[model samples]
Target: MLYGNRSTMSALSRMTEGNRLAQCFLFYGDKGLGKKTLAKWFAQRLLCSGTGEKPCGVCKNCRTVQKNVHPDVIWVPHSGKLQGFSVETVRDICSQAIVAPNSGDKKLYIFADCDRMDTRAQNILLKIIEEPPAFTYFIFTAGSRQTLLPTVISRLVPFAVSACTEDETLTALRELGWPDADAQEAVAAFHGNIGCCISFLEDDNVKLLVSLTKEVVRCIIDKREYDLLKVFFSVSNDRNSALWLLHDLEMVFRDAVTFRLGQDIPSISCDPVGAGMLAGKLSTAKGQYFHKCIGKAHDAIAANVNLQLVMSALCAELMSGK
Candidate 1:
């Protein structure tokens, strides 16, 4: 069950019910928007053996597809290199696609992260995509259509997957047995990206990162520059975790900014007293500056800049403003 993209889902359902579903569909949107999930659901619906609403999940075909055991359903292999999806892999899948379905009336081919496929590979796939066999259906997922070739984009039906609403996200978290407070915090942390929120909930490191983020903010407000240095140093070795910490800080400061504006926004930090104190310490201008610094740090990390240097520079900037 996808939370958002009701329009996309409804359109797909109508296509399925009307027997007019496109042979190739391009599911493009921001990452973590559940495009792949929707593609899988659509695949199951197309291959379903039951007479009920599309994919009757209990049906043998639906069950096999759900478990990734359906012989007629094929996934294009990723090359596991920087370019991803080699020309050879694309050509091979294109050739295999010509074969008839072994199980169901239709054959489904799924291409995940198609945006990462090399231009050469995409070009190689262009002919097959444009004129796939009658029994074959293609589904491709990408962060955006701009990453694909114009020719490739023109040949497929586009399905835009949108972000989930805060309410929809909260409902999903609650249904997963998360307490109200925890679910609220998760929503704030991930901004209603259900996939990200679920990942955050499942990771114990996220809890520690949230606590560390709150403490770092308190240190900055209290002008404890030395303590802030120590805290930043503790996570310097792990760039990935450092990146997550930066994200957590950004969320906290964002909430503080919203709080200062007198908006009753949900906050990632559970400690209202701490958040209020931080909000009082930083005016809108300073909050905005801090946010800018966090964004720069993010770019620096992505550029492979020294983690310790970046963290030290960020801490210094936060303290200097005090």
Candidate 2:
């Protein structure tokens, strides 16, 4: 069940209503915003045999897409430590693009996590994406557009997927059989990010990283560079964990900027108190610099820079401001 982003869904539905949809679409947003979920629903909307309110959930096409078994709806396979599509994989997709769909209406290619798709694979795909075959569609989901090459992005229609409200998240969890209290706790931990909420509940690694993130934020606020470095070194082994850590740390920094601006908005930070401390001490210029450092750290991880080295360099970069 889709949680939120009703506005995004409505806009997409309207596009299909006009039959003016693009051949390629990119759903980009922060992780756990359900970009892939929205992408699948969009596929159902295109393929649904129902009368109105596409993806009529009960339709034959909708069920098949839900099951990922629809002949015309191909979920592209990805592999590698970063879970990227390889050059060979993109080549195979290029070959498959020439074939007609089994259903004769539309053939959809779903690339769920395109955040790590290397430039080589993207370059290999540029020509086909530029001039896709009739009835062939490509949909990509990524954490951000910065991950994709500019040429590839120019050809794909971009849509930003947003997280639902905390209330909506609670409703989604309750529907999934979680008790009200547990649902509330999950919502508190991750706000409207149901995916991360579920992870916080089920994954020890996520729990550890979330806690470590709070500590890292506190260290940053207090200008404890040694403690910050220790925290990074402690979680240096796992690339995904480091990325998650960076994301959370970045959110806290974002929260600090907002706090400094006197904006009391919904926060994405793990440690709001520590974020407040940062707001009090750091100037706006310093805050933007902090954000830049975090972004560079994210870029390094995506570029497959060595995990320990990335962490070490990030520690140095972030503390350099102090």
Candidate 3:
């Protein structure tokens, strides 16, 4: 039952003590901030049949849910390929929500990545949230509240989750048995996102991220045209990782910009020496150009435009001038 940031744990514990069961709760935060994990924890508590403090993980209901074999708990995953929740998915959840729990006291429906729910799907969801079944409870997670329908957000109690502090992040990484140095670097790479830090520790993807960042800085300063597609392929082989890589690239460039603007060099996200070197090479005007290019890249990403075109434009700007 224990997961996520201390603040969120405190809030949930306080609410549990008050015995207030909210029909819906809006959990919003940056990626890797444990919103999904916290949602699962909340759902477990609601489904627990224990006598006290609810999520007695020992309870039969809690055990079934923990093993993901509970008939009463319905989990709807947002389809990453489609890039949004489908109407059918929403309808399915609605149908399941009305049914009484087969074993637990409440029927728990978890909508992961609710931000991916399109307008139509969101509207359908709003109707359900407005009048949830008496014994139903809902847990939804999103990257931002703006991605949700306004009506859906208005009816839900909101919880803002964020990355844990530096110490807590390190502790979480160590709990995963990550090496001290690797843990430190992962924390820096993820900007303290606990989930990302854990992933970086367990995966080979972080190596590509570090390599890509170094290449990007090299290409930026060389002011030479390079195979942008090759770089993209080398770093991001999938849509999900592509999004993370794009965001990480933006942050790397932002650190360079910060260093160029005469900020603390150690404050940069990448290797300090590399950051300072990149900063030293970037003139003020070029720094501004890079920053502008990053903004455009972000817009292209959000619009679901061609990633190649966005990368090409960014490369053109990045290689423009000394």
Q: Give the whole-model CA lDDT for all candidates, comma-separated.
A: 0.81, 0.86, 0.71
If the candidates were sorted by their TM-score against the true structure, best first, what order would they fall in?
2, 3, 1
Question: Which regions of candidate 1 deviate over 4 angstroms?
Answer: 17-21, 81-83, 209-322
lDDT of 2 by residue, 1-322 (tens): 7889888888778777656567888999988889988988999988999897678999899999999999999989888877899899899999999888998578899888898888899999999999898789899999888889999999998999887888888889889888999887778768889888878777889888888988887777677999999999987877788888888888888988998888879887667777888888899889878887997897788778888888888888777784
Clash pairs, candidate 2, are none
For candidate 2, the TM-score is: 0.91
Candidate 2, RMSD to the unseen true structure: 2.1
Which candidate, 2 or 3, has the higher TM-score?
Answer: 2
Q: Indicate whether candidate 1 or candidate 3 has the larger lDDT.
A: 1
Cα lDDT tens digits, model 3, 1-322, are 3444667676775665445556788889877788877876777776677888767888777777777778877777666555577888888888878888787567878777776677888888877888898788787788888878778889887888876677777887777678889888886766567777776667787657666766766666565465555676553335555666666666676777788787763342544445667778777677666767776676566557776666666666666654
Candidate 2 deviant stretches above 4 angstroms: 18-20, 320-322
How do all models score by TM-score? 0.72, 0.91, 0.83
